[model samples]
Target: MENSIGIHISQSALFNWLIIFFISIFGIRDVLPQETTIKTDSHAVVSVKASLLPKGLLGPIDISPAVIPHDQYPIEPQSPMYPSFPSTYDPILTGRCQLNFSNMASIIDKTASDCSAPLASLVGNVICCPQVNSLVHILQGTYGKNSGSLVLQQAAAEDCFSDIMSILASRGANDTIPGICSIDSAPLTGGSCPVQDVETFEKTVNTSLLLDSCSTVDPLKECCRPICQPAIMEAAVRLSQRESSPLDNAKIPGKSVGVDVLSDCKGIVYSWLSQKLSLDDANAAFRMLSSCKVNKVCPLQFKDPSTVIKDCRDPPSANSSCCNSLDIYISDVQKQMLITNRQAINCAMFFGSLLQKGGVVTNVYDLCNIDLKDFSLQAYRQQGCLLRSLPADVLYDNYTGYSFTCDLSDNIGAPWPSSSSLSSLSLCAPEMSLPALPVSQNSRASGGSRGLGLALTLVLSSLSYTQRAIP
Candidate 1:
């Protein structure tokens, strides 16, 4: 006021100066108000906010420490523990029986009047039906018989037995022998129906069917029936496991092939089918069994290991025709191991492509998804199939930050960690922490205190202030 150079020394300017001086004094007073460094209880604030606020959807979408507590300091009997499976599709402990013709007949008979009726119905429907009709839909989408709309119905039906015979006939198997050709007018058969003029009957049936006369087809179920489901399944398992011959004796230890009855029949069936139907046609039936698409390679016939190295000249290479067989093998193995349908399909599809490289044979386990690993963890614990393994502690904490219903008492006696402990760990771990840190900010703030800690503290303070201000 003493050095005022302007005519602004009036009442308004003096009032403004007084106001500014008082504000400055009050501001400094507020700045240093208490000098009381009260460390904000970040955890308490978070707990309170979490308890009060409504949780969003992404909160509980986790796969670990699947169980959570209902209250702070969970009551002993109130909270329960849960288990987890690494993968939704883990392999079943029980082994499946191989599907055979009789088995197939049984399945068909269970659904229909008899095997013949169902078979005939399906065949007739496939043959007479239009391209995009129900018959074609079921075959294409559900139980496929062959790889086509409907054109291959007749050819596929004939080739089913033909392919088997072709393989057998190629090895000196003919229709003139006793055991080998038991279907040829042989009353000495032990099974349901004795062979009655097997060759003539087969030829007559083929000719009749080919001519589209619909004459009663000869019942060749006897050949498939005598094979036995157990034996067939065993054979299929062995064949699948076999690296060389489909029926190599060396594979069946302590047993010798006295006579190649099945082999001879297989050869004859193969020859007949190969002649009547094209290679594509013969493969159509096989494709149905393996569920492969047409023009797409199908699983190969299982080979025997011992004789393969000695007698076989053309061994399957990585790029050879045998890759499809390997693909099927890998797919089957995955099916045996995985339980989740979608996951199993994914694995089958993935490995189907890799089998051609021969790399899958050595690294099958590695090719599997993390879900499979989860299942393995559960299987090892032998706990009833829920929450196979404890999820990461950090994951559990973050997961419980949202609304959830957990039963911690389930594993009371088990030496498992508490949900709280898991939550703490999850909070500590960067991968499972809540309110993830921004990468850019983290990179820019070098040598600064952890951003998560600062961000969480700031959020809690803002929330606390806002609540106080609201009142």
Candidate 2:
């Protein structure tokens, strides 16, 4: 029984050892598959995370088998990448938007409100921006730097940007303030005045004067009234820009040229006046042409003969002796016409009055029947009437055509000689003889008496002639 018991125990121990070996083999197989799965999943998760990163952050570390081949996956050109670069951009927000004053102001106000900054700050920023800076330069070139500066200052000082916008909206895009600023300079701000501007101003003044009728009577006063002050100011500014001394002082460059310019202008004005008024009137008008002052500079003022005489209070007087001589000559002509029984006495009177009033005559019948005061007899002798030659029919159709000569002479100072006789007679001595009449009450009526009286009165009035009478 002891032997049998020993045998069973040994078999049981062998079976237990075999079962343990099989369990160990199955456990090793299961652990090997789990380890392989876990390793593969972790590698896949790492590759996906690396692919999700930005190209800038990811260096040259591609792990794909297809990408590892140098010939197939060659390096490609790439754009520069910066981590701090902005994600988005807006032109208006950056003050780079192109717009006019009104639109710019509106946009600026909107930007300021959105950014929580003041209107002044927004305007300052906008004006200083690159885009706006270009616009400012353009404005400066067109309207002048002084005007640009003023606009800049005004914009910066405004409490409400929208207010300026409204004002800009009301004006045209190209409209500018008149007389406040000119091209190349604005005199109010001590800016440089261009030579072209001065020339243009002078031309404008001259054109205006030439068109005015009153300029003939008082050229300096009438022409300079509108342009004098502005012209003077501009001249001063121009001189200052050249760093030149005063106009009177001779140290300034181009001083003589400037003086000549002013003198030429004065000459033109006075010359025109001389052609229109009598000598006495011209003298008086020139005396009244004093230079105007602007910014302490008097460019138009000069020491010339007329000004010197006026300053000395020795204005020239009209020639009273010449006037007396002309009066005597007129009386002689009238007596001769009366003795000759001429019919042209009324025509002579009409022309005589024109010369006495204006010292010149363009037409014979222009001053007929026109009342005149301050008639200068001396002036009448100096400048005679302009008479057009009468038609042959009119001259020869008269009753005295057989005896009267129609050979009208322009020599007003000397007498015209008769074609039939060698005797000479004054121009006022009519060439036509009186008509013969029958003795009757109707023939010597009121109308005939009035006509004779008028003819006689005209012959007795002022009558004189000029050596160079215009025909």
Candidate 3:
């Protein structure tokens, strides 16, 4: 029984050992492929995703593949991936886009109210209020356009207000006239305004000298009104102050100088009008001055000399014959002047000894009558007045009474006249006295003489010509 029990135990133990061996073999087969995949994936993740690692963790990590050498892979400097921020203070980005007109009007109104109140007691309520109101109207008219910055417009308005205030302060301190605001006041009489004061003020402000100077040279005519008007007003205020009486203690005139009644308050009215004239109006006034004739109602006098130029440009009346005769005389003078100025320097040098000496006036018109027989082409050429080859074609139209062709082809082999001497040449034949050269075949035989004659004619002409003033 003992032997049989031992055999059973031995068989059971062998079966248990066989079961353990098979379990071990299958477990290793399943785990081996998974472990290999994990190792391969971890190596690839480290190589490709290394930049994602934390800063401290990256030092211990070796991300490069074992098979690839570390030196083969170059480390490139990394640049930032986002754009840089823009400046906040840039004008294009920060400048205001819109303007508030109502707010601007309010500012102007406040400025006018402040300046006008103090001025009212001095110049009277009518004159002072209108001045400030006019300024407000001007500001609205000037900057009420669609475009322009509010900042710049405000600045311009402020400058205008400052100017107005300055004018008011000056007047308030100087104005001592009581009832001197009345238009009916008499000039030089105590508290009386000058009747001709308007006319005088107009004459002074629109002086012919000032008008002529401004028209030709003053580019600031558009802005001159503001500066000039105030000056005239101040002058009028002085006139009133001079005329004001200390004995008469009359109250301030309730009846202010009305627009239509300016003839009575001429000084003040003209002063105001001087500043408000448009460019067109100023030009018209200047034109009127210029159009004044010597013997006409508005003669060219000390007050208006511009009419002298006007008579030159256009006569006042369409039927006026004064300028027509004047124009002919002027043309003759200009032609003579041109002839004198154009004489060749070499020509002047050649004939300098032959010219009349002393203070006697030389008449260039007489130069047209010089005898060609006395001059020679050889002498002219020696003075640098001739060219070897023709430089340009001479137009027959430019030479009066000479219809023959004057170009290079017409006179080959002949030395051409220098362009610099053409003006001298014109003087030589001023009356076109040279007989027309023959256009037929026979003309070629005399071509040499004609060419020589032309040269001689020009030289003699220049020698004979002298400077003379036109009457």
Candidate 4:
């Protein structure tokens, strides 16, 4: 009987303690200030110029101070802006990926800016085009002064351009712009335009030639110059990988001549072509280009004492066919067009726009094997139409032909073939549910935590009163 009585008293004490604990916690919550819980279930945008929390727990996060300003550049109030290349749009000459060019260019531009810092402060990562000039200067200061063979010089230039292009292409896609095969048709679209007919390239090469020219320049050079000049220098870096030329019988001993860079240039550039050039096409081109080496066919090959083989004299001149062949090899069959598509999407998305608006079409479905239904095609078409209205010179400069531009942008507004509508798309992944937070009541009302604390305190006080009343 005595043990039972003691057990009952102990249970009573424990119960009272529990009640008091709950009330104290609630009371503490009531005394605390209310807090707002921001639930980011939807897309939440934070601007670069936005003010931060007084406690400094939250703020507009700047990832690369070298590129983006913390409190400077106003978050573009409307949308991201894409790079506007002043030129005529050409499909065949620029590789049917006009959209990629515009979009990728924009992304590169933005990311570059993001990585920069105030001049008064130490400069950070130089990412965008404006900073690319500095990057070039830095690189030149490091390597260009050497008396290395021209092949090395060219390779160095090419590498730099490819790096920049790759960076731009990677960062351009977003919620506004579609992903691969979303902005345009897939590579298969290139197959729609026969590859066997190099006539387009032949014409472009002929047009680019300045009568009896020893070489041909990119047709889009006029428009792409603003963009391509940097790209070309970067691409020229492939020259650095060249092998020293074989010694000629009459030339000075222990001296270097020209260099060939690629181990399999001829094979990748010529033998591996298919119906539609895939992304691998760029890889192949780069492989051949980076492996450029000295051609042994010297005097017969064009005997300039400099074995660089970049130029040929009239007597041993390369036939115009060489330009035609090269054009077909570089522009016609290589996967540069596919890359352009990827780039365009990246650029357009950076600015909350579409390629069709800029008068360029990427054939996302045909080129990237993406289904139309997987994305918002109607939205993209609307954006494309807007892009089409931009300055014509940007189009002409970037694309070599007006026909190419029209084919990409104007046709976007045309009624979609029933087969290609978004409804027919089957590649979309299922959307996931987002988390939600409790809705806030009156701003002046106690928050969840504070209310809980107050209730806890009140419960403790009540429990104490009840204990005294019960005993």
Which candidate tops lDDT?
3
Winner on TM-score between 3 and 4 is 4
For residue 37, what is the lDDT in candidate 1? 34
lDDT of 4 by residue, 1-471 (tens): 999999999999999999999999999977765544554668675443223335555767657534553333446542223222222222222222212234234333433332221110111111122133222222222222232211112334444444443443343311112121122111111111111123322332222222212122232222212332233332223322333233321122232333221212221112112111232332222222221210110001101121111121111223433233222322211111111111222222321122233322332222222221111111221211111111111111122211112112212111222223232422112332211211223312543322211211111011111001101
Better candidate by TM-score, 1 or 2: 1
The reply for model 4, stretches above 4 Å from the true place, is 1-142, 146-382, 385-471
**What is candidate 3's lDDT per residue for 46-73, written digit by digit as tens?**
2334344467863675655434433323
Residue-wise C-alpha lDDT for candidate 1, range 46-74, written one tens digit per residue = 22333344667458666554354344444
Which of the two candidates, 1 or 4, achieves a greater TM-score against the reference?
4
The 10-residue segment of model 1 with minimum total lDDT is 458-467
List lDDT for all candidates, in order: 0.26, 0.28, 0.30, 0.25
Ranked by TM-score from best down, the candidates are 4, 1, 2, 3
Worst 10 residues of 2 by lDDT: 387-396
Higher-lDDT candidate among 1 and 2? 2
Q: Where is model 3 more than 4 Å wrong at Cα?
A: 1-197, 203-206, 209-238, 241-251, 254-276, 279-471
Candidate 4: Cα lDDT at 450: 27
